[model samples]
Target: MDIIEQAAKRLEELRRAGVEVAPEPQPSVGETARKVGAGSTAPADAQGVAQSRRVELDMNVLTAHGILTPDSVRSQLGDEMRVIKRPLLHNVSGKGAAPVKDANLIMVTSALPGEGKTFMAANLAISIAMELDHTVLLVDADVARPSLPEVFGFDEERGLLDVLTDPTLDLSQVLLRTNIEKLSVLPAGTPHPRATELLASEAMNHLLADMAQRYHDRIIIFDSPPLLVTTEARALAMHMGQVVLVVKAESTTHAEVRNAIAAIESCPVKMAVLNKTTGHVDGHGYGYGYGYGYGYAAKSSASAART
Candidate 1:
């Protein structure tokens, strides 16, 4: 089947599965031709034009995965995320304890794999996008192993690496605007043999600077690789003003946490998120908890108790 047919089939499947799929907006003929010429080969149909410019995020899938959606009901996860994002937002708005350069650029990472860093990243992005004044760009920077496609259910497309490697490519061409108003996503893009080198390259620095200044009200969240497992996360951290480290409760060792914090020591603001906690908070089972610290102070105060 062609692109439009495939999209129709997918929407049908989502509908069959009881997902409330929103009707896609139709773009003008001129707009469709512009997108088609830009790189998208989708047919000149409403669905095709919509698919080229926007993606319909499945609310049911988000809920099933324990992610906070725009229409998500009030719950412990929502409450916890609010608390976790408050300080980060403060820094972004220049209201924190200290002024943070490029405070809008935030990276979410972990010391090791399987620590729920990606999960935290997605939730944080979604939470931030719900804000009234700020918009969010969720970039999948884990080049070697991107998971945002799976998390958001959007097909993999050209993104961060592609822009850095190809001088001809523009960030606007690869950015996928989602149905969620205020949220857009940049996929990991075509993987390269020198992904690590590309992320640290001067080209990457230029792209980051452009992204940081492109929209004054925009916050860019990078779901980066594990700091201890790969060099990419550390390289990305060098450009990020704030970093959120995900620490699995009762699983991630204190030594590992310390090392992870040390890896991103160059970041102006560092925060720790205690994930997968087993306990009841406010009469609800806890899935996430957080601790805020900056610099070496996090190393001393960051601790998780066994349930």
Candidate 2:
């Protein structure tokens, strides 16, 4: 079946399963062509949303082997990282040799909708977790769109918001183990009308601060929403040690990127991940399994250099 039909069928299945599926926005013919062309040339973080004649890849198939490969995460990231943002891997892996800090938080945000911020967050978390000896926690902070539960197959009754709202709730109670050995996920709890308020609460801060201490050796990645859409992302950005912005080529105006950066300029290192990227962006394939060296690289490279 065609892309539209497949998407429709998936939505139908979701509805049959009692999950509410939002209506898929239809793009104009001109807009459709533009997205396809843009997907081909977009930067690393932005290129994953392609107009392919295929259904969403089954996460079950990927996990059937009992291990999550770098290629599996890379493929989920789509073509954008392949082209424009590939250099980011080097930048993230090449930051100066600095003293390593504990699980400093990283919040992934975008300027506007459809920039693929959550998609990048999920893949990046998995990629980071794959590094030998490293553990990673991927938090779905975007309660508005809540993709983690779907991506990792977790129930919505238990998660971050629930724990944050209930003073008696323990963080460990909400943490769910995934198929990946070192990766754990905290899905966005059932949608709440007061999501922003919940995210901004002191309880949330205490939860994260405590989580940082408990998972000191692991990386905590918050997959937040678009800054332009709500203040939630900006609020979360303040707590993070680093904010990685995913900017889509062509689709994202330069002004949008600058404004998002300017809003959170206080962040020590706000790395840009250009998605829907073109291959020439980074100037190399650096494809999966170039060497064990890639696996050994630590995020201390992402720490603020003395420079």
- Tens-digit lDDT track of model 2 for 36-154: 77665422323243221112334564343122345554442333333322333333444523422331577888899766666567767766766675677788899888865554444
Q: What are the Cα lDDT values of the candidates?
A: 0.76, 0.60
* Index of the highest-lDDT prediction: 1
TM-score of each: 0.76, 0.64
User: What ranges in model 1 sit over 4 Å off?
Assistant: 1-52, 280-307
- Name the 10 consecutive residues with the lowest summed lDDT in model 2: 298-307
User: How many Å off is the CA of 196 in candidate 2?
Assistant: 0.8
Model 1 TM-score on a 0 to 1 scale: 0.76
